[model samples]
Target: MNYKTFLINLDRSPQRLADAKKQLDALDMSFERVSAADGSQLTPEERACFDKNTAQKRYHYDLTWGEVGCYLSHLKCWQKIVDEKLDYAIILEDDLHLQDDFNKVPELLEQLKTPWSFIKLGNPFKPRKETPVETLARFNLVRYDKAPSGTCAQVVSYQGAKALLAARSLFFRPVDVDLQWQWEVPIKILGLTPYVAGHNLSFDSDIQQIDQRKNKAKRSGVRLREQLRFFYHSKLRGE
Candidate 1:
């Protein structure tokens, strides 16, 4: 009952932010909006880095590193949560619209107490399941799997926040930069499990990007080869 909300937004998307605010207010939930471009709360070096990182990206075209700014917003919010000594918080972007009668705060807090890693709310696709999740699985293998999409609606625990921060410095590879949900890979490696469910009302649409590459669906033989190398990597690390 005592969690904070992070309303992450971009100044360019005023309409979306207003919409999300209206919906949250109707639900009686208070949130603090954080803009990545706003430098008052962030250091000059940090602001410059974000600008350098997000240089040429937009809603659908921003490359992966462009997301570093968004991740920075989440980190700032996490710090606030820790400073306030709250257990966790629900994070949102301006694009999400919640159900009119959706007040699952208690339910969400309960789930966070479990071994689960994260709970997602917003997506660009239709809901995959109708029930509130009581349990979710932590993916434990060096293999790629098709996960449910839309990570905007989420609950971030204190541990989850720390783990994400840990990933920022450690996983520096630039694969899947333009693809949303690419963060899920690091989240998975962090041993976080995502909820496979949704509520009655959510801001989801059945929109998908054009797979410009004709071979988009084809798995890069790299995945299988990478799994094989995990054994060697594991042995070298003595894992």
Candidate 2:
């Protein structure tokens, strides 16, 4: 259970950071705050990882700047895990509500005898097909047949961090979506359910706002392509 925890928060969003701090403090879980990358202010070096043409070709649509920034923010956390040689690390976004049982995560992980790379601690918005892997005292560890959206909170092992960092050159999809591409990382993403954390919904999401603006300007062909990809992945590929 010796692990580091990082909370990603935009510098302009001090209120969100304060809110998150309150929750973590109550749990007596100390964490480092990782300054989130602001898409609007990305440096040339940070922007180098993103290519509009590549994004359009891979995701069937142009990624919003916010989405790209979000991915970069996560990359910083993964790099930290590798640099510090952490056994595992909990990465958390600023807007979240941690359940009381969240503190028992270490105990839950200790029950696992086999190796695990990534485990999501947050709840999925919709129900997902998953097979039970272990029955812990307060939560069940399950292997997601199809990983869900959202990067609100997750525990990533050193191996998971390395795998994710190795695939950074191919960054196109959103971080959450990329995590679902198990073939890319070749990691089995697991989940803890019933979830120990969830989105705090009170704060408006900057990424959601950016997504809305981008969606309004999407081309008809891009929309169609997105629909096709969804169908292929969900129905055909059974992912």
* Candidates' C-alpha lDDT: 0.48, 0.83
What TM-score would each prediction reach against the true structure? 0.56, 0.89
lDDT of 1: 0.48
The digit string of per-residue lDDT tens for model 1 on 1-239 reads: 46788887766557667888888888888888877433234355654444323222212222233334445665666666666766777776665657643455435346443364444544445433333333323322121232334445666666666656555532222222212233433453111223322332433321112122233333345446544654464455443
Quote the positional error of residue 160 for candidate 2 in Å: 0.5
Q: What is the lDDT for 75 in model 2? A: 92
How far is 85's C-alpha from truth in model 1 (Å)? 2.3
Q: Model 2: which residue pairs collide?
A: none
Residue 191's C-alpha lDDT in candidate 2? 92
Best by lDDT: 2
- Candidate 2 differs from the real structure by a C-alpha RMSD in angstroms, to one decimal, of 2.4
Q: Which TM-score value belongs to model 1? A: 0.56
Question: Which regions of candidate 2 deviate over 4 angstroms?
Answer: 209-213, 216-239
On a 0 to 100 scale, what is the lDDT of residue 197 in model 1? 22
